[model samples]
Target: MAPENQPTTGPSTFIGENYHIWVIKIKAYLKALNLWEVIELGEPVVQPLRVNATLNEIKKYDELVTRSPRALTCRHSSLTNVMFTRIMTCEIAKKAWDKLKEEFEGTSRVKSVRFLALKREFELLKMKDSDSVKEYSSKLMENVNQIRILGETFPDQKVVEKILISLPDKFE
Candidate 1:
């Protein structure tokens, strides 16, 4: 029985053709140009390093390479940090809020603002009558406002200011 026709599957081996040799030559060319790193798997497999990252994130990682937008290699940390920054921005938080609002509206629920106010009023009333309830309504209200601000889908000046203050200026 020919190996090609064998139904048994674990891992199968195959022979390479002249195209494989051509690919090796191209990889060599890329290496010479310092465009890519060629990882030689025992069977002549070439892995290109800089693949599958967003344009914006990649640009921040390496300004020179991003300016020309050439194929180059990157470490996983670089790619991960780019993705992390995009996710952490206030704009992403705002999208999440918008989606929540849409879902709440579809369910015929009272608006978030009205619901929050009513809840606060009830909590205050309970606090006045019952000492056991112990409601932190003001803190809750502040948190709600923060969430609404976060859901604006844009960067906030206050956030930028805070970040700037936290980091020491090397130049000054």
Candidate 2:
């Protein structure tokens, strides 16, 4: 019955890049608002087939069906125009979220390709001679985040070791 409040600062727009990060942020926002179950499990069907259903009871069931979708719409509205258009046709939030996931996140084949590409990038990562320690650290962490999102597990110690190895001899 109450309107869902908008997130004070929504995630970055869903451009061709940044789907992983954007979705993660969006999901967190939705979960915080208690709207994630609808997106993840869909709206539950409230059976109105009772032989003696009261009018108020039917209305209550109707509200339940619409509530999740409305919450999703509020959250989805934060997207950029192009991204909004992509999910505009979805009548409910679950469908919209799924459509976005399929479109940007892709299927297993695409995910595998992306995972391989991230792995390659991680392997080739290096601290350039001209790069500052901060810059190199940021680059390494960015790759680490992407790899993690793609379902790779890299222990903190291993990441630390990799960073140490990547540093120039001057840092030793």
What does the lDDT read for residue 136 in candidate 1?
35
lDDT of 2 at 19: 79
lDDT digits (tens) for residues 54-161 of candidate 1: 786566556433321232221111223443333233232223223323443333344546546644543343222232222434444443444343232323454344
Off by over 4 Å in 1: 1-58, 61-97, 105-109, 116-120, 127-130, 133-172
Identify the leading candidate in terms of lDDT.
Answer: 2
lDDT of each: 0.35, 0.79
Residues 6-103, candidate 2: write the lDDT tens digits.
55654455655777888887778777666788888887776755778789888887777777877567556658787788888887788888888898
- Please give each candidate's TM-score: 0.18, 0.76
RMSD to the hidden true structure, all candidates: 22.7, 3.7
